[model samples]
Target: MKDRLFEKPLEKQFEFDEEVAAVFDDMIERSVPFYRQNLDLIVTLLLRFLKPGMRVVDLGSSTGLLLIELARRCGVEVEFIGIDNAPAMVELARKKSRALEADVTFLCEDLMRYDFGGADVVVANYTLQFIRPAVRGKTVQKIYDALKEGGLFVCSEKVLMEDKWLNKQIIDIYYDYKKGQGYSETEIMRKREALENVLIPYTIEENRSMMKEAGFSAVDTLFQWGNFATMVARKRGK
Candidate 1:
């Protein structure tokens, strides 16, 4: 299914419902800036760090395509678990995983209260932004606590700039990029309206600050385009 969801006027705010689940793969690749490239970077990083029997968890795993592909390519017997709050998304992800016999587990649960059980590598691509601002820091802390010593956390998010002028310029450039991806101006505007307040973004600095406070000894950005960025955080060995 293609992303014709926003082609018509939205009946409700954005959500990971059954309807969106049908076209999410197409929607993400076309809506997000450098989405494919960022995912490739994540794959490379995961390949480098994955070890036998290690637990790798993905927050908001969506369709679980990333883990499925990684399972197909990965040589190690690492545990791959994907957590999602949306039942529809989880169902689709499990369906896809079962089709390929991908060694991945899809769980429908809120990440905020989920137990990670000492995971070695945790990923949250375009996930944290949806969390409420008041408790976002606590969520990062939970993620940090879930990891083992010397664990790795990779996160990708849409960031906001404090500078109003530069912010508008970046958004303009991003809109142009979306247009290049084949979205009509009306589609774009309608989608923006749907995502308003539903998708809250933070500054890159704010994200880094949360990681640092969460006990990640090192946090560095690995990729960026317009307002989107991928950051890697490392926990120190005790």
Candidate 2:
């Protein structure tokens, strides 16, 4: 695991630490209904190929939400490793993982530096966008190399859309939804700026091409909501 990934920078990534935690907690507790409404569509499309006892890695796992769902609710006995760069987030996630009794571990390591030697399922839920574009290809290749033959890589992300009108509409609706969930406009702008400063999001087609270049076979979108999408790709069985 790369220690430098956890090197904290001086700039404030979040305005208030407690507020950040509150936002995350509210999202988890109150947003379950929204997630449950879409879980079957997303999970079925992403995990249909997965089997029991396969080791999985959750890259950029925040609060360990998806991994817990996969382990406790999905009935998979796979050992899970959840990696994130935020120490505070990792601590919270570790506590949750312990409380849930899920087969999971949390590591405060950079996704770019982590050695993924035995991953069977690699998940990056809204996290890969933070990777620098120049190194993104190498990161995907690392994921490909880390996987055993026929392993699955699933990612859900907010992407850059090509159509100008559609892109504006997507951003509008996304923030509108966020506002409806009780975030102030100031808070929403701050969140957007923070993400923009960190994440180098790509177009859907660009991501597909990158995955293919990284040696993934059968890359395809499993679910899409405007700019947000879920995709699954497979490593070729040798």
Candidate 3:
């Protein structure tokens, strides 16, 4: 199904409910610029670092598409875990994994409180931005603490530009991009209004600073396209 979720009046703030979960795969591919390319980049980078028996966790894993792809391509015995707060998403993810016979565990739990255990790679694709700014740092810290020495944290987010005018221009361009992807003007505006205080984004610098503060030894952008970016941070203690 296409993302007509915002075509009608929203009853409440944007959330990962059944409606959203049902169409999330389609929505993300169309709404996010270079979504597939970003995932491929993440998989390739992770493959370089991951070893047999290493564990990979994907925060806010949605329908488990990334995990499925990773499992299919890694060609090694690696643990794949996906965590999401939405039961609907978790259920759908579980179902898909079963259908594909992919070795993935999907858990429905609050990410902030979940025990991350020791992981070689943790990914939060477009997930951290939804977390409140005040506690985002703490969440990153938890991820850092949960990683093994030299572990990697891959985060992808929609970022705001520091320049106010440039920020507005970029947003307009993004809206136009959505329009080109078949989203109507009214649907775009409605979705924006519903996500007003819900989907808060930070600047790229601020995101890097947060990761550094959380004790990541190094951080760098792996990929970027206007407002969207994927960052990699490494914990450097062996």
Candidate 4:
């Protein structure tokens, strides 16, 4: 899966990819204020897996929302690196960070090939769906290899499931909820198209297994809201 996701050339240049960026930028901005209300529990759980001074990488970081939030709440001397393949998005992120003078750096690079060697904690929030399953395992292994012993990895994603009915039900609920939150039906359709166009997603079980196979000492789903999930794993120390 990882291979497939990465193999699809990021042919769309950054500036011309505003359609992609708009989908996310608006979505995150709309969702940001609600994070404390909706995701505090999960964020807390993921936080238990971290410590001060950790070298952290926000893989597939879109606008650096999670990176910014984590840094704000962590109260630690952590180095934050935000990685993404989209140059336009990365530049936007850098602009935002500069305005706030936040200590986060955005790198325009593919997560599949990015070196994670010294990272202590890696967080890939809502960005795993686009990763091809074929290279997913290798990507996970690369993440593991990038970490020092006992390092942590947290990935939040949109998952795939075997039950078609359940999938639709979940997707329906998602659309309805988003609509209620002010997204137009057309907007909702656009978002769905973006995911489909990008070839997004993995089954929950497949993700857990991928993490374990990549040499994580332990892997577990810490939280889920319909198809959205937070996966936690760790590299074991000798």
For each candidate in the order shown, give its overall lDDT on alpha carbons.
0.92, 0.73, 0.93, 0.72
Question: Estimated TM-score per prediction?
Answer: 0.97, 0.83, 0.98, 0.82
Candidate 2 vs candidate 4, TM-score winner: 2
- How many clashing pairs in candidate 2? 0
Tell me which residue pairs clash in candidate 3. Answer: none
Residue-wise C-alpha lDDT for candidate 3, range 1-238, written one tens digit per residue: 7888988987898899999999999999999999999899898888888899899999999999899999978888999999999999999999999998899999999988889879989999999999998899999999999999999999999999999999999999999999999999999988989889989999999999999999999999999988999999999977
The full ranking of all candidates by TM-score, starting with the best, is 3, 1, 2, 4
In Å, residue 145's CA in model 4 sits off its true spot by 1.2
Worst 10 residues of 1 by lDDT: 32-41
Of candidate 3, the 10-residue stretch with the lowest lDDT total is 1-10
Model 3 reaches what TM-score against the true structure? Answer: 0.98
**Model 3 residue 170 distance off true place after TM-score fit, in angstroms:** 0.7
Best candidate, lDDT: 3
lDDT of 2 by residue, 32-61 (tens): 225454545655654665677778888888
CA deviation > 4 Å runs, candidate 2: 1-22, 25-48, 74-76
